[model samples]
Target: MTGVSRLDDPMPDSPSQTTPIPPVDGVLTMFYYNDLQAAADWYHRVLGFEKILIAEGLVLFRIHEGSQLALVGKGYGSQQPLAGTNKGAILSIQTRALQQWHERIASHEAEGIGHELHRGGNGRTVEFKVRDPEGYTIEFFEWVE
Candidate 1:
């Protein structure tokens, strides 16, 4: 992680003299849930995401080598869970084993909300969407080559 700069820091005389910004090493996407444990179980059982860290009202899962997914419980995050519909965001995962993933998720019909694999626009990729316990969409896709 990079150090935070203060607002009162001296300004650079020119662009070349400005402090360099550090490179981003990884990314983390946080999702809020009312029932945190239930959501965590669903993600583990269906998607096989391994939990890296667990804390009070927070759970982090390793999505890949460089990215992670954080699940924040109610009252711990800025926004509460949507009452019925998940409208704003979709958690998308890109993979090369499209059919395999579809089959794996399809087997867990009780927990997996939807499993309709189809071609994306312009025939560039094939994808499918599944809803988590809290109605958040998780899309898996594979780029066509």
Candidate 2:
């Protein structure tokens, strides 16, 4: 056989064969909102997110480093609940600076607000939550270990 490798042949020994695949880079959570621009704007104002795109049926925002939140406009497809409710889901974030994150969220003024620091009974993590404009819950956490 010539030096050229065939498709059926095993690869010659090389570092590439043992290299690991890369880990996940980020996450994007989508929320259905009838008033898409308003929902995007409210998140931008309250949580310091910036608009990343205004594509067909969705407005994307960068909510944190490597994390995104999208507001779905009319005609977007989802198994979402009614326009203003999310009863069984939460957007949980892992953060290192819990206190600083709390300070930023607490600056916002809104109805149905929720914000408090909590320590798990066994003292493993610290966390807090703040409700979004449309009432979906977002939790932030940091491990004590």
Candidate 3:
């Protein structure tokens, strides 16, 4: 208790207790896959994400400082992957090294990685999209000044 705050302390009604709570410390987006290990390996090899943790049916990769990507095996979670294209969503990551990432992903011969890197219509970002082994779209972009 030396360096920690306790709710049971004398200041039970302190502002900290009444506040809406602190800002979100991090974010993790989950993608369901029938082949979890294959998806995990694809993310690691294609994107070069670092594996921060792994479990029975889930593997977490750190995208950056506070963002993570979670790959969940089918039947392990509430959601299961669809038999066809899972176009429900896309994961877009903002980075300053877009070209570097483009080069790395291109070398892997990943599907959809052949798309040319182009600037946004708004002229604010340069980006390209690549499909993971499971057909998940992962977009990498860099904001322009």
TM-score of each: 0.79, 0.70, 0.80
Clashing pairs in 3: none
Which residue runs of candidate 2 sit more than 4 Å off their true CA positions?
Answer: 1-25, 81-85, 110-115, 120-123
RMSD in Å for candidate 2, one decimal?
11.3
TM-score (C-alpha, index-matched) for candidate 2:
0.70
Evaluated at residue 15, the lDDT of candidate 3 is: 83
Ranking by lDDT: 3, 1, 2
Task: Put down candidate 3 lDDT per residue, 38-137, tens digits, no spaces.
Answer: 9999989878899999999999999988999999998888888866556698899988888888899988888987557898736667899888888889
What is the lDDT of every predicted structure here?
0.83, 0.74, 0.85
Candidate 3 local lDDT, residue 142: 81
**Candidates ranked, most accurate by TM-score first:** 3, 1, 2
True lDDT of residue 42, candidate 1: 87
Please name the candidate that would achieve the greatest TM-score relative to the true structure.
Answer: 3
Error of 1 at 10 (Å): 33
